[model samples]
Target: MDAVNLEEQAARQQLFTTLYQKVFPAVAKYVSKCGGSFDEAKDVFQDALISYYEKSHTADVTINSSEGAYIYGTARYLWIKRYKQGSQTKQLDDSSAYSIIAETEAAPSEDKLLHFLETAGKRCMELLRSFYYDNLPMTRVAQLFGFSGVRSATVQKYKCIEKVRDTVKQKALTYEDFLE
Candidate 1:
């Protein structure tokens, strides 16, 4: 049993080493292009590897792409999330920024939008919220919504968006009148 465990550990280590070599450079380049530092790239890449490992080990989740591609994609997503959070924090800390942002907006009230969406039906609201607001991947959204696959979830998302669009058009409201 110890021998088997040692072999498994060795194999996992080799796999990760190979993945880091093959994947890290591209992830680093992407992060750099997105204005992240090398340390941030490395941190996000490590997080991506952990995410990939967890998802791969899950019985219901399947990675459809090459391992490097999956890791790179995950790293990109992590970096974007981190960057957005950082920017939002910075924005919140700058007091004068709020007034400038407020001056630029003329849109339907959140209450009105929520009421319209609520009228669109519960399932549409949940589906839109999961995909857009929660930023869930299509596969996870599919699983959560009991969809057969990603394609179905994607189609359903389009349909829900169209439903909202149609409602907006029926009311003779321009898209900009919604929200920015």
Candidate 2:
């Protein structure tokens, strides 16, 4: 009813639209790939989105990666949390269980990747971040990044990945640097 409330509502709508167009479907796919169903994926993504939004609203909240990357990371965290809470305590595969636990507890790597992307073109960095790091749906990402559709986004994402991969490879040319 109030002007401030209306503005906030509009902002919320914009956020939802941006997320719906940029976030959801990719996360759903990742969830499904990791042995979750569509319904489960939806639930997980919804919780992740809520957490992301809350974090976003906080002062000086700087996302070192694309919004998609942030969402994916959050979704993965929420999914792991849900799994821990669920009664499926029986181990399915021991190695997988270990890897999953390791990944879930690892520290964030956004800032490091972001610094790499910064030297790359802004558009390329955005595309790479959304697709590879964030795991956003190609369909929506294509539209957001000015591609024709999902197909283009997919191809572009592949190319961008290659670029990043190449960059990493080049940087790692010396084995001594990587040695502890």
Candidate 3:
């Protein structure tokens, strides 16, 4: 079984290497002409390759007839599907757009709330982290936090949530407050 798995992995690696060599330049050219960066082109090409491979494995995909064209078209379609979805027609080449995103994410109001949570609500935050962030089961959380059982842990979890909810309501957090 291990040998068979190794052989399959080798075949897949070879296929990927061959496809990237044979088809990537054209995909990169198309992406660049479309004003996308080299990294974005690589991402699109890799995703298209994986999609093509998966489709070929599952069905009678006739990608051999025009491998280059098929790969390029798939990559372009994926890029458009990913980046141009909804009514958003944002340009990928614009650095300013990304910087604006970074700025908004760094909003001062949310930071203040988070900092307050860190200080004032540290124990609740720790419990939430153990259960939710660390993905510990209620049983394990109860064990770690010295609760009697899962039910006790779960009740405490809800209590923490209600406390945070009340705090948020009391402070009247808004979208702008959440944003940087």
Candidate 4:
């Protein structure tokens, strides 16, 4: 039993060493092209290697690609995940500051804009809400709205936007006339 365990360990070590040599350069190059530092690339690659090790050990999980390709892909995915998380946090911090200022200055205009959207009719409101506020993909929006396909849903979205724009312009002019 000890002999078998030792042999398995040695085999695993050899596999990892070969994978590191073949895959690390490609992963590092990809990370560099994606604006990550060498240290970040190394960190992500290490995590990827660990993930690959875990997955490879599982009986039900079959890797369809070569070990190097799998490792490189995992590294690329990890780097993108890390990059998105950092950028999202940064954006939230920046947007919090801007939201405070915009709320105070734009309250009246925001109300007027809401009124214009309300006048645009309920179906248009639902369509826009599904696509923008809910962040559903065009295909899902099409499914929700019973559109023929993604192309139709996209076309309708733009038309709805144009309708809202025209409505806002016309209402603003009338509102200005009323104030006078």
Pick the lDDT winner.
1
lDDT of 4 at 158: 88
The regions of model 4 sitting more than 4 angstroms off are 91-180
Distance from true location, Cα of 135 in model 1, Å: 28
Tens digits of per-residue lDDT for model 1, 1-180: 699999988988998999999999999999999888999999999999999988988999999999999999999989999999897786444667776687577555787788778766899999999988999999999999999999999999898888877888788986556664
lDDT of 1: 0.89
Q: Is candidate 2 or 4 superior in lDDT?
A: 4
Residues 33-120 of candidate 2: C-alpha lDDT, one tens digit per residue: 8788999998988888887888888897876777788888999888887877775776569898888887677645666666556656
What candidate 2 gets wrong by more than 4 Å, as runs, is 87-180
For every candidate, C-alpha RMSD to the true structure in Å: 11.8, 17.4, 15.0, 11.1
Of 1 and 4, the candidate ranking higher by lDDT: 1
Q: Could you arrange the candidates by TM-score from highest to lowest?
A: 1, 4, 2, 3
Q: Using Cα atoms with residue i matched to residue i, what is each candidate's TM-score against the true structure?
A: 0.51, 0.46, 0.45, 0.49
Report the number of clashing residue pairs per model: 0, 2, 1, 0
Tell me the deviation in Å of residue 170 in model 4: 48
